[model samples]
Target: MDNLLDFFKAYDISLSQMIIVAIIFFVTIAMELSIRLFFRRYEKATQHSHTIKILFYLSLNKPLQLATMVIGFYFMAMHVLTWFRFTSFFDQVVTPGVELGLALCFFVLMNTFLSRLKTYSITKKTRTDGGYNNFAKIEQIHKLGQALTIAVMVFVIAAILGLKVAQGVAYLGGGLAIIALVFKDTISSVFGGLIIYLDSPYAVGDWIYTIDGTIQGTVEKISWRLTHIRTFDKRLIFTPNNLLITQAVVNASRMSNRRILQYIGLRYDDFDKFEAIQKDIYTYLGEHPDIDQNCLTLVNVVNGSTDMGSTTEGFFGGSSLNFQVYTFTKVTNWLKFQAIQDKIMMDIGRIIYRHDAEIAFTTMTLDISSEGAEPSPQAT
Candidate 1:
């Protein structure tokens, strides 16, 4: 050390100060290497652990290296300043620079911790039964944590730089109020997102449709201001969260069973077979494996006008004998329900055919009265 210092003494460098700077520089490098080595070993050892893999995604090695470098730079700067007889600059600039660097390190560390915590929460929830029920809530909390982390870091950096934190916060509050006024719709959508988190009306992957039938799709994502839905046609829709709150939504995915309701009409000539056909259809539904026997199942002759104003009085004025079939299928999947419904409909048709009945279609009969007919004037 003496020889190294003496070598520089020719330029009037202080031996003791030079030695201290050298020590600081070596120590910084050693600390950086140590951190790097430690993290490398830790990563290798825990590579197979799922939890560790997630939590350690944000490594602290770089931040620690920066912190060590900053400390070394501060000490070297102070010693050099003293040698130059400019010690007054230490308090004005060097100290604040060190403080900012350290604060930045801490900010990064907090962010990393928060990120790990969020990953752990999501992992834990996904592993448990019924975890998806609260997934929206967890996402909301994670978003809130990130916002808070940033806000806190800003305040800390302000304080470190000799700014009055309270005054700055007051100014920020006022600015936010102005922003809110200018962006009322945006703010409302954010609140709507919060409501969804609390109410959990629907989660990602739920098939939903509006009561008015204007929108029908599967929920892809829910963010602060918008919810993404992928329509059946493969188009993506970005709906403002506020709209979801105001409109009535039906979560089709939650239905216990899919309904099959139909009105089957038979030709008036088949009126004699109506009772037998209805009985046979009802019996078939009761024995079907895909139908939900526990639900209300009906196969009845329509004796009067239906609520939809369809008259079923074949002998009175109607053209055909009408009967209604109402039942539910055990499967709620749309494709599977269609298959079951098709099979049932074909079977019903065969049953009617066996009874010598034909499904009815609209018909008209033309009549010419001899007394009122003028002989087609001789073909002109």
Candidate 2:
């Protein structure tokens, strides 16, 4: 061992080099840690959230750290500055620079994404007063951002691997196209989700009823594959985004309340009680405290569209005398709507019965005789 030490000494492996290497070793560890510590200090000193503070500082310092690590290699190699030129300086930055950039980028992305996720988790619970369309859009935003980040990662990796940008894109373009075509439903769903998002449509918790005999329900979730809704019947419905985007949608929770315009037809024979019946119905709805008074609330004659084939227009004739009431109730929930409706209907039945009004129905009378037709009491 003594002889080996003498040999190393005689070979002119200077003690200075040993001391320098040692210093570099310690400093390298310090460099890695102190950089983190310094950022942490500033991050902790502020009123901002720890995550946000780190995020803000990271954005400014990531590239700077890469530059510093390149500088550290000089001290680590124990090389003299007179020999190292700009070309050598760049060379040192290359290996470490590539690694540092990707690491920093990924960290920033993850941290920011997590911060947004946390913010979403907390704030989404706050009453947006906006319908499920807006809420669904919130989730969609995060998902789209994640997808974009993933794509960026793919591009960056290809770039780092010395692949040309165009070549990388070309290599995947056809595959992506075929994949998109295969999963065309999913791609269409994203577009539909975006339509709902950008157009201020429904969110993930609104009670809605569609025209296609679909009843009202609470929107449960909006995903890339489907938008789920929980019906008041405790049933779950998965609607394709394409159906929602292209078809008609009614957002019941859009306003602070709901406006219900309904019709009740009475037989023309009981027309004598029309005035009194209208007054009673109007008074009851007016006195209801849960109804919004700010909107129009009086019953009036509403003309249907001019199309004779239309149900509304058809209802206009035959002495139907449709009385349209424009009123809004404070409740938008399905249960509350039903409860209010039941109360109103019960009251209406009582009033209609008291006035001896016959509610109209589609009935046909057949007359039968020996040769012709006459009504038969037995059939009744």
lDDT of all the models against the reference? Answer: 0.80, 0.65
Each prediction's TM-score versus the true structure = 0.61, 0.49
Q: Pick the candidate with the highest TM-score.
A: 1
Error of 1 at 289 (Å): 3.9
Model 2, range 1-380, lDDT digits (tens) per residue? 88967865665566686677677767766777777777567656752554544555544444445545655665554343322334565556555464556555574655465545646454645554322224554565666676777777766666665679898678788888998989988888878876766675677667677778564687887766677989878999888777788777887777677677666666677777878988988887888877777777876555665232235443344545555556777776656766776777777778777899866764456765576666589977
lDDT of 1: 0.80
